[model samples]
Target: MTALLDLVLDAHGGLRRWQDARTVHAEGSIGGHLWSLRGQEGILATTDATVDVQQQRLVFGDFTGPGLRGLFTPDRVAVERPDGEVVAERNAPRAAFAGQGPDTPWDRLHALYFAGYALWNYLTAPYLLTRPGVVVEELEPWREADEDWRRLHVTFPETLATHSTEQVFYYDTAGLLRRHDYAPDVLGGTPAAHFSEHHVRASGLVFPTHRFVVPVQEDGRAASEPVLITIDLTDISVT
Candidate 1:
């Protein structure tokens, strides 16, 4: 790992600790204007999240209401009941966004794909950058929120479906991930600034328990109003 990556990982409980965990669980509420515009408001407002630490997989229980869950992975998206009965399933789900635009409304599966990969990426980072086929490079410092934050530009292999193949991660002097910038491919590559704060540790792993996403201005800073997405986590644990 790079020196910058090591610093950030150590601040977030270390890669050694992360490798010891298999799964992560959390209870959270997620919402914002993005949902409203995508016609999926309240879909993930409140739910139990389970993520695979070793793979790009996540599941939101009660996602479609009680007795059901939304499953997400790079290859598939599905809705199923607790009994393992799948209500619907789509293979190679990312292709579903072929002709999507910023104003386009998303179906439940589309929302499932977006939320699933996003949370997985968020929950397993710094360490995630060390994965095979992932490239990380430290960039010049960025002045933001009154602090000069270090930046990293990461490129993910096509096999890994994330907000975008190329994205930037900003870390504070203390090595916390203060902000992240990416373009949501499903939204026609709209620039976005995602902020991470209210950090908490669970089973020796660190996470930003509260976060919000907004538009990125020409200056590479976030616009203050109109929050696109808000995520607050409670009872986070890794095992």
Candidate 2:
């Protein structure tokens, strides 16, 4: 394991603990005008979500609207109703976005794929770095707010369905992740900076309850104002 990843995993919760805990449950609200822009408003709003950490599967329900349950695996995404009837299913969900851009009109399946994989990736971080095919390297320290923050440049293999293959993670002296940067390949590779804060611990695991994803300028820096997406997670538990 890389020294940086070691520190991060230890800070959040030891790798052994995370490995033993097979799943996590989170009930919360997920909203942002970014969804509206993509024609997927309310798809992920006010939901109860569960993630199978090792299997990389996510199942969520109790959306803002009725008859919407989301199921996502690495290779497929499915939307079902309360009656257990699937409304949409897509194989190789990531490929469904081929030649798509931010302005592309989104369908239910598209929305499911985007939200499902995105949340799965977020809820399983640092620990996910320990998975096979992930490459991690220490970068020069980044100074922000008069503090020297350690940085890790990570490259995810194709097997993982993240926004992009390459991402940068920022950590505080205590080894908790403070920020992450990547371009959403499904969204035409738009650059974004995600900030994590308001950390709360549950069942030996630490999580940031508040997350913000903002647009980045051509120089690959965050925009001056306006967060594009905001995710607030409450009632989080790991077991």
* Per-model root-mean-square deviation over C-alphas: 0.9, 1.5
**Cα lDDT tens digits for candidate 2, 1-239:** 77888899999988988898889898887777788888877777787889998978998875435657888887988878888787778898888889876678888788777888888888888788888999999999987668788999999999888889999999999999888999998888878989898888889988889999988788756785566778899899998
Kindly list the per-residue Cα lDDT of model 1 for residues 1-239, writing each as its tens digit.
Answer: 67999999999998899888899998989999989998988998786999999988999988888879999999999999999999999999989999977778888999999999999999898678989999999999999968999999999899898999999999998899999999988788989999999999889988998999999999887999789999999889999
Candidate 1 deviant stretches above 4 angstroms: none
TM-score, one value per model = 0.98, 0.94
Model 2 lDDT at residue 72: 86
Q: In candidate 2, where is summed lDDT lowest over 10 consecutive residues?
A: 61-70
State residue 80's C-alpha deviation in candidate 2, in Å: 1.8
Q: What's each prediction's clash count?
A: 0, 0
The runs of at least 3 residues in candidate 2 whose Cα sits more than 4 Å from the true structure, single-residue gaps closed, are 63-67
